[model samples]
Target chain A: AQSVSQHNHHVILSEAASLELGCNYSYGGTVNLFWYVQYPGQHLQLLLKYFSGDPLVKGIKGFEAEFIKSKFSFNLRKPSVQWSDTAEYFCAVRGSASYDKVIFGPGTSLSVIP
Target chain B: EAGVAQSPRYKIIEKRQSVAFWCNPISGHATLYWYQQILGQGPKLLIQFQNNGVVDDSQLPKDRFSAERLKGVDSTLKIQPAKLEDSAVYLCASSPAGVRAGELFFGEGSRLTVL
Candidate 1:
């Protein structure tokens, strides 16, 4: 079974501060990685995903993640964050070969001070 | 296009009572999923459906929980004799088939409060 681990449970940051959330998965074979975000009183939405091609992938809202196969990590990064970025982020992973189930991490709550 | 639709945005029930949540996936989507999201935790897959057949229900507590997608369009999840631990947000998601099959589009979720 595949499992995802997020290093930080909660993160506090000021406006314009750079942010990075650590995410690692325990899967040996080829896998698909995704970052999902849920704002206050909203449904979960996809932030970005990495299936193949370049290691780095960009998604909506200037968010990006890099799939480091060697490290088994796909940490999310943003050079600057705004107050609207305050939300809960979840990291998910699934094997690419078959219809494998996607496993999610505990999630990281980000609170950006305005 | 409209996103996934879920009904009974909030539900409250006493212990040992029953509750059911409905979900309508996006049009043309070939897969539907039901996930349970406890407070402060990420969503956990309770069941997955590819069309009308079940793809996975390994994490579902089958003894108390039951779900079905009869027409391969809308789905219903029912829990009989609910427990306190069953209190969570039931999220419905769907994805297209083929290359984009894994990317999920989620619903607003149905929140359940077991007292």
Candidate 2:
């Protein structure tokens, strides 16, 4: 079975602090990676996705993620984060063999203090 | 374009009761999805539909849970003899067909409280 793992369960940071959330998946085949964000009381939306790209994918809101295929990792990064960025982040993966199912990680909650 | 719409935004039912939720996906979207999101956890895929056909339903609890997408436009999910562990937010999402791993537009979700 394919699975996703997010290292950070919860994080607290001050405004303008840099952010990097680690995500790793357990799959040995072609895969599609994605990061989704859910704001308080809001539905989940896509942040970014990587299929066959330059490894570095830029997304909306100054967010970017690097897909390191060898490491089986796709880490989301932002040079600086604002209080508005506080939300829950989920890493998802869809294996080529089973494109119908997208497995999601446990999620990481980020709290930005203003 | 209108985003996915879900009905019965909130539902509370005792264990062993039955409940149903409805969803209307975006116009022209052939792929629809249902996910269960427990508090403090990420959304878990329960089923996926392509057009009027079932594309995937591996995680759905067949014994007590059932879903159908009629006419490939609207969908309904029902839970019979609901269990306490079934308390969660049921999310409906949709995407265009043939877009592999495409972005999913989600609805506000139907929150269920199985007491």
- Using all chains and alpha carbons, the TM-scores for the candidates as numbered come to 0.98, 0.96
Q: Model 2: per-residue lDDT, tens digit, A1-114?
A: 889999999999999999999999998688889999999989888999997859999999999999998899999999999999999999999865434567799999999999
Cα RMSD, model 1? 0.8
Write candidate 1's Cα lDDT for B1-115 as tens digits: 9999999999999999999999999999988999999998889999999999898999999999999998899999999989999999999999887777688999999999999
lDDT of 1: 0.94
Model 2 misplaced stretches (Cα beyond 4 Å): A97-99
Which numbered prediction scores highest in DockQ against the true structure?
1
Question: Interface RMSD for candidate number 1?
Answer: 1.1
lDDT score for residue B93 of model 1: 95
> Scored by CA lDDT, what does every candidate get?
0.94, 0.92
Off by over 4 Å in 1: none
The digit string of per-residue lDDT tens for model 1 on A1-114 reads 789999999999999999999999999899999999999988999999999999999999999999999999999999999999999999999888546777889999999999
lDDT of 1 at A12: 100
